[model samples]
Target chain A: MVIDQIHDLQQVYRKVVHSMSRPGSISNLNNITEKLEDDLPCNHAFFLCALTVLDAEVTFHVVASEEKKARLIEILSSYNMSRIAPVDEADFILLLQDAPEYQMNQALLECKTGNLHDPQQSATWIIESGLLSNISALSLSGPGINGTQQLQTGIQQDFWQRRNDKVKEYPLGIDLVFADFSSQIACIPRTTAVTITEVV
Target chain B: MIAKPHFAFFDEGSKKEIRRATLKAVAIPGYQVPFASREMPIARGWGTGGLQLTLSLIGRNDVLKVIDQGADESVNAVSIKKLVQHTTGVSVTEKTQEADIIQSRHRIPEKALKEDQILVLQVPNPEPLRKVDAREYMTKRMHAEDDYSGAWLLLFEQIMKFGRMSTGASHPVYVNGRYVMTPSPIPRFDNPKMHQSKGLILLGAGREKKIFAVPPYTSVESLAFDDYPFTVESFEGKACKLCGSTDVFLDEIIDPDTGERTHQCNDTSYCMEQLNSEEKVEVENSYV
Candidate 1:
């Protein structure tokens, strides 16, 4: 049984990871064991795909309440993992929903945005919500931006106040990966500049 | 479910980022370079960080050595050794003299490393300024200009309360006389080994998504005030029970059946070698 479960984990993980890396890439994860019932579907997928890649030696921050932490601990413990590290300490930050701007930015600033030579040292956020796509929200143009993609959402009020300030410190901000249970992924790297505008 | 771990446990892109960060770290000597750290087959607090660094730097010819608390038999050490051996099929040794690349969790070998050796430490926390500055952006700017006043202020605060700095482990050191780098969880006893070492020193935080380097033949000094200059810890006359050697780190092992506790050498391979060589000498003397 252990072997079978491990085998299933390996197969589904590859697809889930591919979906997370490449934007618009979709992959459905099938291993929804008894362990995943309590969390949001997106967070369940995050644990299946994310924790399969990170654990004991790789620190992560889960931005959920004590109830959620206990549930996560129970689920993660089944995999021989102990303790959920704090947000600042975690290498991966998992949020079961799109956070208010302050919380998101706070999490972002707490992440390690890599040093000079290798700018890829940024945090990976598994937001259990949507990375809204709209032209008036924020402007993004980079390797994954499709020559300039727009994120349309009511980006939190505080996030906009510091948007330009944060963007000016390019390649030193958080990189986000929003995953829906259906298995969709979107990312914004430090190199990509973002500008806020209202929807018409 | 995830696919089986890639060749060295990291995908090509992840390896590429670590490789690039490592190269830059090498270029700047003591500078910390950030990489898009990928989750390895290991857990976060264990040695995921060091494993990633080893994966990035390892090639076909490297001889790997992994140790936790200085012992080859430690559970975490055993786990890492298995991963490296399985992933790379490279030769692994517990002997400090034989290993070309040593990935360690919390201790350095008692034997002095040669110029060609590489010691990669697994750091739980990479930033020394993190406690003072909660904001990464602000700390980056401070490090950019070599501003560490906040760190001193904290240390001063420590002295005020305790009359001395009580920090014992994960002590900070300036690598290559430039960037201030953390030597992970190693005790002050091993911190001296970081200074002008014969081998390259690398630090990685797998969960923190950062990697840093300290080149060979460079300065790495623990931060200290003149009034309370740094001091190294010694075990005094305590010797490793397994090896009967006095120079290595010791571990307090409690017998499972009996609640009795005893001291043993943390470096199991070294201890065993010492025992073997001592027996050999006794045999030779008897023959003579």
Candidate 2:
């Protein structure tokens, strides 16, 4: 069973990398049941998404509750996880669909960015939301942008507002990505401008 | 060769971006140049930093040498060498002299590198004030503004208690009298090599996604207070058990059976080179 979990974890990681490089794309993970979807506490799946490798030095976070933290600690330890975080110190922020329940503020304060040691090493926020469109609609512009490209994600207004609050820090802010539960992702680097309009 | 992007390892378009940044790094000398970096084949902490720079600067005819702690045999060095060879079919070497570009992890070679030589250092963490100070935005502003009193105060505190600024590896230095820079984790002994040496010095951090440079013949002053001037650590009483050299960096390995520790040069190739040159040393091993 542990072997199966480990193997699935590996597949999830490759998917994340492929999507990031291609941008405006979706990665479908075949392993792991959909039943375990909501049960995933933090972005452990999201963490596993971009994580080609996990060591004692990289960090992760869980701010929802202490019980959640304890459970995460158990799961991460079983995977030989290193550099686990208090949500505040995480390099990557994974927001489950049900997140922002009671602890979003604490998670926000804990994730304030800056440190010349690694300016770009600042935390990245990834939220899993239901897709609202086929993605011929949204447009994104920023540093990674070659020009306006149709960005696709089904995230709502308030979701982006939460991201903007973090984004206002300018060069010192966190980058955001909204991925469908389908694994289709649109990245809004701190420099990216997101404008949602309906396709005529 | 590890089939790379459309043009060379990094696409011509990507190379253009890096080349523009390299120009800024050269123009500004020591300033950290922010770049839109891409993911490379190698892992970050290893030599990804230097690998990125090498990939960007790689031309068809260039000769490259990669060293970790001054030895080419180190696994990380071997891995990076393989990657560069894969992307660009340029000749790679173990010796520091024969190469046009050298990507080094720690120790600077004992031989003086030429002005034509380009040395790239792999940086794990580039900020010197990170552990002691808070705020990355402020640090960049301070570096741009040349506000270094805060860094000095921290060193002063260290001296008051420990009698020396206790930074080992990643030792901070003012590069070209312009920007405060971390010479990656190279030993302080190699710090002098950065001062107006023949080679252009570039630092890269793949995970952090930053690349900065110190131009040839530039001033790089390691931060130090007047009363407690900066000093480089030495092997002191220790000598390499293999080469019997006292001046080299020694790695201490504890013997499990006797609980005794044996010291040897952290540089495997350097030790072997010493044995080969001196008639006094002979063993069944490859040191011949």
Candidate 3:
């Protein structure tokens, strides 16, 4: 069934806004994800998020296996009409569950972190990961967070470290959104200061 | 007689562009993210920025409140409310507590906002450096280098001229301890309310085509010297004439007939809420 673009996207966008504003907060996208037909190239929640923000005005890049990347790009472009740019120039970069650690790190390093004058020009990384949990090794404290918030994600520790290195300078960094198989999503914006509390 | 407009008035593409800008604005607290600001049916300078944000974010179930300088019934507020209601058919309210999204100009609601609610402020000027330096390119470079000496110099000049910082509204603030931002033209009294606010606050400048945000729980500090501190408008020994409340922000009024000066609550809805509750308590006491 085709989702109502106006209503459904509005709901999804609100959740995205909530997650972005309050880092480490998890937003459940099952209401919209459950309505999607099975067998999409990307996660349902990720697809909904892409649809909510992507259009002809922007560009995106997908980081996945050769075949999956092509299919995901084709589907995203056809649906949203956003151009498929290179990794460094893409406004939105998608990291599928199948992406290797090395590629994820490379994408993290190569993605645009926007200059100080116009930091908002940076890319947003939308990753399809394993299950998302509230309690994890990562502790976040920053603009959106009231105090310190504990969050756990299936993403590798190296990626988080690299993200920290990329965003060491204020106002110049990429934002992250992680969507798991359970239709749960969370975001860590550039303003958030993330620290790995546990090795595991 | 007029055909119904698209959902939220702007086309889906325009909404998507604005949403993208808004997301980026939220991600980088207080950073002015530029976007293609569309023309609305209303005039540009008159709350179009906040109206665009309200129209883009309003959902079918959301309760919207529009206030111009704290008056719910002001011409700008009422006109914008009617436009949104006519376009989306959503519910509108005067009570700040009942609003899911509050689009405001010049003032924040007197009551504390909840975490779920969002405040969209219309900004006449988004650039805090515009007054210090007129060149956009030079100001961009200054911001890129973390050089806000010009802003400080402007404040220092104010002190030299008036013996006190004479900024009445649109006071500059340091957000997340990085970028200096103008919290819309909100009075200095409302500037403190933006610090670590429970609700998300988004400021949009439609004419300027800029958007910025202060996410919930963020640190928003007004710029001030250690000795010359930032102070809000004092209302000591003053109370709202209508509600008899002393804590809230009050507007000075002059009696037209007697030429006597009085102070009253600027937030009409908040003052009305106080009055209604007092009446209820009085009724219950009489019965007892």
Tens digit of per-residue lDDT, candidate 3, span A1-200: 87789989999999999999999999998878888988788889989988998888889988899899989888888987889999999999999989877888888889999987789889998889888888968999998898998889878788888999999887889899888888998999988889999896
Residues B1-288, candidate 3, lDDT per residue (tens digit)?
978789889899988888989999999888888888899898888888888888889899999999999999989999999999988999999999899999999999999889999999999999999987898888888878889998899999999999888899999999988888999999999999999999999999999998999999999999999989999999999999989999889999998999999999999999999999999999999999
TM-score of chain A of each: 0.66, 0.67, 0.97
Tens-digit lDDT track of model 2 for B216-250: 55678998877777778777888888879988777
Candidate 1 Cα errors over 4 Å, as ranges: A1-200, B1-6, B252-262
lDDT by residue (A1-200, candidate 1, tens digit) is 13223334443433432332222334555444334555343355566555454554455666655566556557665564535566665656776553344566676566655554334444556566544444456665532223455665333545545544644554345545555544434444334456655543
Q: For each candidate, give the TM-score of chain B.
A: 0.89, 0.89, 0.98
True-vs-predicted CA distance for residue B221, candidate 1, Å? 1.1
Question: Fnat for model 2?
Answer: 0.00
lDDT of 2 at A124: 60
DockQ scores for all the models shown? Answer: 0.02, 0.01, 0.89
Tell how far residue B76 is off in model 2, in angstroms: 1.6
Q: Quick one: best DockQ, which candidate?
A: 3
